[model samples]
Target: MSKKGKSRKKPRLPEEQDLDTFEFRPTGLNLKWTKDLITVFDGYRIHRCYDLTFIERAIGEGQMPRSFVDQWRFIRTILHRFAAVSPKIPGVMEKYKRRQVVRFVTLVLLTIAVPLMVATFVFSITAIAP
Candidate 1:
């Protein structure tokens, strides 16, 4: 094929190119969320310390039969569960949740509205044509 007839491929811009290596650099929002989560966990730990102390005393007194390994495992499990369901961080998580909901609703509306608009435009044009 002649060079003139051959289709030239467009060169990709830097922004259009796919990244080869992905490094997780947390954004300001993510850092804020992390700080809030840590704060909540710290507060939760402070409140639960007395319960933990009581449990430890019970085990030491032979009232609750639990091995050291079992006790550690139990504590770890409780902390993990708490972290998973930690109450919504007052501003950070609540805002994130609301944004997600708004985004979803917007996408759903656009998905329905765009096709309807296009169909209406096409029908109107056909009606106007001879």
Candidate 2:
């Protein structure tokens, strides 16, 4: 008896919301969180680094593939959990900013180096022939 054939429905999954594309995109906070989460394991705790042990266990439990253990989704989940538990941390943004600066500098240096090398090669060739 309704005029509209179908009513619009809200998203059922929280993860599916606010996402514009189907492709994966882990937030900067999430990456940092994942980095922090790896410290919980004994091997990782001693090194203060991430290792394959937790991922291997998840794969053994059939939660994820052995190969996909280190995939973006796995890391993102850890990051999301980390974000929930520890939302605020001093100097986190600064670290990300530093990383960005380093990436930019490396790109600029490569750009300049390539052109300078090519120009030097051309100039040397012309000088030797004259």
Clashes of 2: 0
lDDT of 2 by residue, 1-130 (tens): 6676777897443343333444433233345445544454333323334444664465568755343433444444444455544225677668868989999999999999999999999999999995
- Report every candidate's CA lDDT: 0.55, 0.55
Q: Using alpha carbons, what is the TM-score of model 2?
A: 0.38
TM-score of 1: 0.33
Clash pairs for candidate 2: none
- After aligning candidate 1 to the native by TM-score, how far in Å is the CA of 34 from where it should be? 26
Best by TM-score: 2
Write one digit per residue (lDDT tens) for candidate 1, span 42-80: 766653322345434544676543343243443444555
Stretches of candidate 2 exceeding 4 Å from the true structure: 1-79, 83-87
